[model samples]
Target chain A: MRMRFDKELEMLNGEIEKMGNLITTAIETSVKALVNQDMTLVRIVNALEMEIDEMEKTIEQHCMTLLVQQQPVASDLRLIEAALKLITDMERIGDNAEDIAEITKFFGNKTFINKLVHIPQMAEATISMVKRSVTAFVTKDKELALQVCYDDDIVDNLFLTVKNYLIDLIRQDVNNGEQAIDLLMIAKYFERIGDHAQNIAEWVIFAVTGEHMNTDNIGKTK
Target chain B: MRMRFDKELEMLNGEIEKMGNLITTAIETSVKALVNQDMTLVRIVNALEMEIDEMEKTIEQHCMTLLVQQQPVASDLRLIEAALKLITDMERIGDNAEDIAEITKFFGNKTFINKLVHIPQMAEATISMVKRSVTAFVTKDKELALQVCYDDDIVDNLFLTVKNYLIDLIRQDVNNGEQAIDLLMIAKYFERIGDHAQNIAEWVIFAVTGEHMNTDNIGKTK
Candidate 1:
């Protein structure tokens, strides 16, 4: 019975892995659409959102069934529950991508002042973090999870850079403020997506070690 | 045994209620800080964030213990699971309030093109949604839970109004861009807090009915 339960638990992980892959794909399409100004890709990402959400609900249901049928305990139970929580974060990461696509719709034919410099780099960094956060879950590597937290500092610095840069742009010309402000929001949403990815890495640590890992790193013994 | 278990669940709910109350207070303070531009309240909200993080961890630990000890089935298990998920959304909502406070710090000692009329109203709507979302769980009131979903729509419409209003502000003068962007982000954060609050309300509905509530009406149905 326990072996059967293990397969089921493993299947739960597989489903999450698949969901993570779709989210990554969604992010890719969203960025492509935004960068290339392709409304087609944005529309696809929008339509695919329902699929991603359906996958999320399916994974949550599977996790619940495991808890009920297997009565998971110790690390196993935590892992399943962590998957439940992590998937929500992962799903919202997808939502942020959709938000980006929606923002692209608002921009229409306008050119961003920076010519898409920071946003794409931010997306690249964010997708890297998303990949490693989930990889940390599959491997249960605390160091990898910790790296995810540290890498988030880079994202924060990026957010500050983009915000200050936009502020400077608007201050210099004042008339260019319209495009700059939209780009600023686009950057802000990307930064927030990175933060959610960090949240998933934290959940991976919680699952493996039975501890809550706050990004603030307070109240810990060094 | 069941009586003892019920008592344990009550303790868990009581603990969450305290955290809920803290968050409500935080929202109240953050908005005051925002409107009054009170640095002291901003710092207070920032400092209290650690306590909320600690409370989240404490609740997670307690929930795990109950899950392991009680081996709760069906409704019992679902209730604890819902609490676990609830704490997460609650914690993120707390973080959103803190983000708003942080935005207040960024505003410094300046007034802008657009007035700050809608933000306090948005904050109040989110806080009420959160308070009632948790109450829906405690009282198992599907009616109230569903009502929270409608309330989420109010915030969404408010977001649309704010977004369009800010967009027009950008188009009109464009000089107000930086300040407009800041206000827009602050508004966006409050809108997201509303989303998370709506998420809690959905969880409450799931816990009560053992089925996911429809989120189709999220920004529209109300």
Candidate 2:
């Protein structure tokens, strides 16, 4: 029975890793679509999002079945519980990526108000955070998970830079107002993606040590 | 053993309801702060958010204890699982409300911006949705839960109205650009609160009917 439970746990990890990959692809494709102004890439992001959503349902059912049949105990129970919470954050990362794509659609081939510098940087930081958070979960590497939490500062700093840059653009020329606002929203979406990644990393800590990180300070900084 | 499980389940329900009430207050106080330009209300919202966060940790511990001690089966198991999911959504509702209050702080005693009409309306609809969603979860009322899902449309339409109003304001006077973007972000936060409420109602349905709602269509509309 122990062997069977271990095998099932391995399968669960694989499924979660696959979901993480899909989320990474979605974030990357969405940002690429934005920088390139490519509608085709936008369609790809939407499709990836739908696939990610379906994977969430599948993984959830798997966890529920394992709980009912295996009746995991102690650390095993914590692992399954953390998986449930982690999937929700992963799913939101996909949603935020889709939101970015939707805003990119609105840009409609117009020249960006400024070269897309900070926004892409924010995306890179979030995507790396997402990948590392998932890896930490699969490997149960608490140090890597903590590292993911630390990486959030990079994304947050980029967000402030983007916000200030947009504010300056709006102040310099009223004509830049609409696009500046759109870009700000996109940057905000990336920042949210970072937050979700941080949440996932925190959950990993909980699963490993049975102590949830203090997330009360999450939005307080903003 | 069955009787003990039932008693613990009742406690779980009560804690969830309390968390729900905290979320409602946060939402109401945040909106009031925005409309009244009252920093005092913003402070209240912030305090309420921290309390709500503490409540989440406490309730989560309770759920973990119940699951480990009783090993509930069938419907009881479903109820506990739903509780776990519900609190996450409830916590996010509090976070979004606090976000709105934070933006209100940015307004900083500025004079009226077009009388603040639809934003207050959005707040009202979202508060109702949050309240009804929690009530449905505690009472196991599928009809009321479904009604909460339907009410999301009201919030969505109000968001579009708020968006257009802000766009027009920015068009008429470039001076309105910064405030308009800030106001737009506030409206978006309310919309997110509505989304979280809808997610809670859907989970309530999942607890009652063994079938998860198709959330695939969620961000597709936007």
Candidate 3:
């Protein structure tokens, strides 16, 4: 019975890992589409978001089933709960990615806005954070979870840089207002993605160490 | 044993209802602060957000305990799972309110760029939606849940009206850009709060009927 329970737990972990991959792909493709103005990529990101949402529901139902049938105790219970929380964040990441793609569609063939510097960097940093946080959860690595939490600072800083740069762009010419707003919104979405990633890391920590960290500042635009 | 389990379930429901009241208060105060530029109210909203977050963790722990200790089956399991999902949406409502209050702080005594019309309406609509959704969960009323889901369209429509109005404001005066963007962000937050409320209503439906509704379009701006 114990062996069977362990196998079920492993399967749950594998499922979450798969969902994490979908989230990363959404993040990567959304930003790539923005930079290259690739409509096809935008459609792919949108479709991936639907898949991610479906996966979230599937994994949630699976987690609920495990809890009902096995009545997991202690560490096992925490693992299921943590997965439950992590998937919510992962789904939000997918939503953020789709939102970015939506904003990209608004650009409407406008030429590149200020070379798209910090925005892509923010996306890259955020995607890595999502990847590492999921890995930490699967491995139960407290250290990696902590690293993901700390690494949130990088994404936060990048967001500030993007905000200031966009502000300057608008100041230089108010004619840049519409595109600048769109770009800022996109940057904010990436920052939110970073925040959801930090949330996943914190849940990972809670699952492993049973210590709840204050995450109030995780995604705040400080 | 069954009587004890039922009693415990009632207690859990009461705790969630308490949490729901806190969420409603947060929503009310945050919008009041935004319109009135009340810094004190802003502080109140922030503190309430913290309390809401704590309640989420407490309720989550309590639910997990109930599940593990009692090993509830079938309907009971579904109820607890739905509560788990509801609290998350509730907590996000708190966060969105806090975010609105945060944007209020940045406004810092600035006069309104335009008359506040749809925003306050959106707030009222969303607050009612939040209240009715929670009540629906407590009563297991599918009609109320469906009502809340339908009401989300009202909030979504108001958001679009606010967006277009703000865009026109920015277009008329370049000086209006910053405040316009801030207002837009606040409107977006309210829109998101409505989305969270719709999510709660959907969970209520799921809990009562075991039927999942497609909610991706709930709070989306058309």
The DockQ leader among the candidates is 3
User: CAPRI band of model 3?
Assistant: acceptable
| Residue A33 error, candidate 3, Å | 1.7
DockQ (C-alpha based) per candidate is: 0.37, 0.41, 0.47
Each model's lDDT comes to 0.82, 0.88, 0.87
| lDDT digits (tens) for residues B142-216 of candidate 3 | 899988888888888888788778767766777787778778888888888888888898998888888778766
Quality of candidate 1 docking, DockQ? 0.37
Residue A159 miss distance in model 3 (angstroms): 2.5
Tell me the lDDT of model 3 at B173.
78
Model 3 ranges with Cα > 4 A deviation: A217-222, B218-222
Q: Candidate 2 or 3, higher TM-score?
A: 3
- Cα error, candidate 1, residue A142 (Å): 1.4
- Candidate 3 chain A minimal-lDDT segment of 10 residues: A213-222
Superposed Cα deviation of residue A122, candidate 3 (Å)? 1.4
Candidate 2, residue A87: the lDDT equals: 98
lDDT by residue for model 2 over A60-114, one digit each (tens)? Answer: 8788777767777778988998998889999999999999999999998999878
Model 2, C-alpha of A27: deviation from truth (Å): 0.4
Best by TM-score: 3
